[model samples]
Target: MDAAFAEYLDEFTRRDWETLDPDAVADPVRVAVVGLGWFAREWALPGIARSAYTEATVVTDVDAGAVEAVAAERDLTGVTPEELRSGAAADEYDAVYVATPNATHLEYVEAAAAQGKAVLCEKPLEVTPERARELVAACHDAGVPLMVGYRMQTDPAVRRLRDLLDAGVAGDVIHVHATMSQTMLGELGSDTDQWRLDPELSGGCAVMDLGVYPLNTTRFALREDPVRVSGRTRSEHEAFADVDEHASFRLEFPGDVDAFCTVSQNAQHASRLEVTGTDARLILDPAFYEREDRGFAVVRDGTRVDVDFEQVHQIEEEFAYFGHQLLAGEPFHADGEHALTDMRALDGVYESAETGRPVELGD
Candidate 1:
């Protein structure tokens, strides 16, 4: 390996190195990465590659050129998604990592379950609630572990925020306000992965991609699902004619806990999540993915307490958590059900946005 790549790999795995022990991780699931996209290569796989408890044995991607390049770099063979599911290569790995775009999640998930292979799929689980629930249920019936990759939920800073809430430092989660925005697609639909501009491929714009952080993290922090949701989706720029370029929504929890979020495809970069309670309020600055540093602050009547956690490698935390569940022989945190909950809430958000009315939710 080149020295630069070697250094990068070391840095990637060093932070979360001791998170999992190979010996303690029973049956130690090996991974077959089904997509070699940006997240799969730079963010997800590097951790899997360096993890002691898990190994990536094979990979598959629709982009043949990308897959071939990755295969050569990693010295691993690439297979077709079909081959990964049930062809000659079916039994080669213990789990599958589904990192394809939003729309294609269900297909890979179902295929993985058909072979009784455990899966760790990326966020939005599936673009639609029905498919999300079906995939989760299928994995359940097939007796396979299904985990959705919500990296921010595993963040140390985010975890500390949760701890504070759990400890009642925040009294009760009376309200939460979060906003995530970036201008990655400056030219709008003209950017790479232009497919994302297609509502069919992206599900919805900012809400499906960026808003989901606040949407899911609220549930993670409060440990409660919203009882109702209302939102507005808009295509601010002509460039995003087909898909929403920006979205803002509000979620109402059972206790009247009010959570509001703003996500956009074209905006000055900002990522923040703050939760308010009777006694105090907690804040997470730069709270989502790809942030260089995520910091937390808590404020009481007249006092402010701040915590700056060392950046934890969320991918390692995710893999370690999954491995721990495998060793313990049980479904645990961030399981399929967890993803389903977020999907249900998101479903309502979309409905409310489309109907210009509040959509109620249950369970």
Candidate 2:
């Protein structure tokens, strides 16, 4: 290889690739999980159990029976949501992990904030941007930390991509293409009456649920919020009558960076993201979904080089990062205000789709 080319490659590889070390905290954060739904049971609980910096000390839900069963099975204290809100077991946990439906997030988050507990609310912040603002204000008023669970931020590959972009390895980013889809009905199998189909509970179907992966992931990688959006959506099936089954949106960011994103709840399972810049293109195929393996590559001058990163339990990393921030008394990057940006941008997408025009997001 030529000397100049070798030096360039060396510089590219040496760029800061640092990622959060979740095990930095010596003390674990005691957590009370505020919902016992399928995601909480299947992913959140297991992830907390495996995390080095956090542990589930209490569990609660609206359903008393599910709370009892989960608490017993996990050897955790069981409490009703009302009891938790009333501070009956306030001393048991230092934080609350809320995994409830979209619209119900504010209630549990307010209760947690009232008790001065840090909150790790699942994504979208809340059903609407207005409600999300309320939730953020609640946490701010109580002077407690509030983090939205955007697990992609904790993934090492995604963080590495961010570092590379920040290092100018990709030059000036020109555009991004992202799409995420899943066969929701195929996976759930006739459970069409679930809360996901209810607009009130889920906010929206594909856009709010599946679409946020690309939208938030791009924001994290680019460190830029979208300034405007144009969107389109379709919901044909009876199950999706109240919400969108397919949605597409375009985002305009600062510095002329634009993104085209698509999401579907009725399509075959897939996730892919690509960012093209003047210098090279970065790709993360099979992107958003939690997986045991992730593919990453960089293409420059028609030469493709794949990069390997450590495989991690994304949810566990999220829990550990939350715990580390709490134990260290550090400000979180994905705090409530950060989440509010995405919430507002998402609201813009919906408004644009409904009105058949572009929506501008205000700071």
RMSD of each: 6.9, 3.0
Model 1 steric clash pairs: none
What Cα-based lDDT does every candidate model obtain?
0.78, 0.87
Model 1, runs deviating above 4 Å: 1-27, 186-193
lDDT of 1 by residue, 109-185 (tens): 88888888888988888888888888888899998888888777666667667766876777866789999888857
Taking all chains together, the TM-score of candidate 2 against the true structure is 0.93
Model 2 agreement with the true structure over 25-47: per-residue lDDT tens digits:
56688999988887899889989
Q: TM-score per candidate, in order? A: 0.89, 0.93
